[model samples]
Target: MDKINLLVTISIIIIFIALFLSLFLLTVKTAHKLSNRLFAFFLVLTAIDISANLGDLLAISLNMRIFISSFFFLQLPTFYLYVLSVCYSDFKLKRKHLIHGVTFLIANLVLLPRFYAVDEDSKISFLANIKSMPEIQFNHVLMHIQMLFYLVAAFMILRKARKIYLENYAGASIESLNWLFQFTVALSAFYFIALVKNIFKFTEYPNISAGLKIGLVLFELIIIFWYLYKALNNPGLFRTIDSKLKLVQDIILEEKNSNQFTINEKEHSEELLKLQHYMMEEKPFLSSSLTIQDISVAIEIPVRDLSLLINHTLEQHFYDFVNAYRIESAMDILKDSTKSKLTILEILYDVGFNSKSSFNTAFKKHTGYTPTYYRKML
Candidate 1:
């Protein structure tokens, strides 16, 4: 097929896949209903945005084109909201979120006077002179600025959420968090390339612009397929953190500044000993879904104190702290001659690691060898 036909065919497939994913997200029976809905909406917006690629082939009218293009304003904001929803379990669709659509409203207002309110002949004339229109220029600039802002904000949220996950949850949760982080990074890279493509569009090099556009479509196609593979392989990929949870560092800083919380050296040592005893004797780390709050309750320590003890005094994240014990337990099993028949998978699950990949990673990090290599040496 010709280049235009190939591009159009790819765009059509992307739209179909995007819509299919959106429908699946909307209807999927998941704990993160709100997050799924937000993401579904974002996907729908994406499909609409991609539909613009078909304008010429479909003989799309100017008004219809304008309507479809207007959704561009909502796309990134919806994505931003989806990021927020994924990060925070308590996230809800608040009335204040409507403010995100202000740019869309403004874009429509800008078009009203020049294009939308005019007749077909006038609209075509306006389109011919669109490059010189200040309104079009302003909207283009605004769109780019909004994309930059939302992409940055989404990244910051993901970074903070990952840190919080490390400080509060166990190692098993890392895979899901890493998946989300990868998704955000991929989207960010896509947006950056799209920005570059937009810049090239105004340059004299039409061929370069077209090449970038094709590359973007191909990049997007890969992302969707990768997402599908991940989603199908790991049905429980999404995990949420309580929005009210504070970072351990933030808690420590606040306590130090306000002098509202203090622990003497003796008390700190006592708590550390207590935590260690419980971890050793009770083996609380055996629970794959363990959290710092669970440890606090089991050891009769305050959550804040537990956070401070493991995250601050021990100089280790709660995740690493728990995983350390689990790794130790797995090591003991590996060393035992009586348990020679126990497979690495069996040992991993017995020691609270739900995923073999996480177990292998933690074991290798702790022992400088993969579980298989470590076992073979013995």
Candidate 2:
């Protein structure tokens, strides 16, 4: 067709492909299957909603076009549920949650008789009339109202979840799914703008609605592709929230971020001793992903002060300080007669070193000999 229609058609095709890829990767590759499955369901609802628009653009038959309005009300609930799945560790799509989609179901049921009554020739007329019906008009208004409510609710959940996560384990390498937050914000803005424009018919231009639809299609395509790229690269992006850790981390982050604490030199040395005692007792270095931030949180010292003590007082960088403990731990494992059956790789992993090369390098740096050589000598 024309350039505008061509762009819409291309965007539709790209979105379809992107949706398939996203669903496939999210279902197969992700760690937390439940959350990813929920996300995939959201994408499916989005695809159905967009497909209805594409059907209108293609002048698809009345049978296909008549039901397009029925799918419109499901988008917000699906999105909100998806957000719930990601942010809550124990979220389950219970029967009660299906109440959110009750309006969609009722709307579709009410239209079913009309859908069958309209023939192919009169389908467009039927669709036009359906839109004008008092009930349908009410539903249309209600859809936007529902959208506004759910948008706010979903954002509140996400913001709270993210805040909790950062407070507890700012140093953890867990995927935060911040993209979903951005997506929801963008979607809310797009829908709000569309609602306002439609209500006011703000444009004098005859074709502005078509242009807006095309622009929305383009924006959705961008979001879909970005989602696909991230899903493929980071399969664990939708993993379940660590609620317990988040709670604890929030407490720690609050304490750390607070400005009320101070330390004199004597207290600094005392805190340093406490750090040493905790390190020796807890051996948090056994976690490969441990960070100075994690340590600082655990020790209840400011990260800056902890870094100063490790780097200046102990004459070691944070990484070196942690690795020094890991290497030492590995040596103990190697030297222990009862642990003689453990493999070098196993020993390395046990002490929190993720790779053999790093373990070997650290071991050699500390002991002036390779692990295997040291073990053999022992």
Highest-scoring model, TM-score:
1
Tens digit per residue, CA lDDT, model 2, 324-351:
7888888889889999999999998888
Query: Which digits, one per residue and each the tens of the lDDT, describe model 1 over residues 179-253?
Result: 877888898899889888878777777678788888888898898888878877888767778878889889988
Clashing residue pairs in all predictions, respectively, total 0, 3
Best by lDDT: 1
- Model 1 local distance difference test score: 0.87
Model 2 lowest lDDT segment of ten? 166-175
- Model 1 stretches with alpha carbons more than 4 Å out: none
How far in Å is the alpha carbon of 59 misplaced in model 1?
Answer: 5.2
lDDT of each: 0.87, 0.70
Question: Given candidate 1, what's the lDDT at residue 92?
Answer: 91
lDDT of 2 at 21: 67
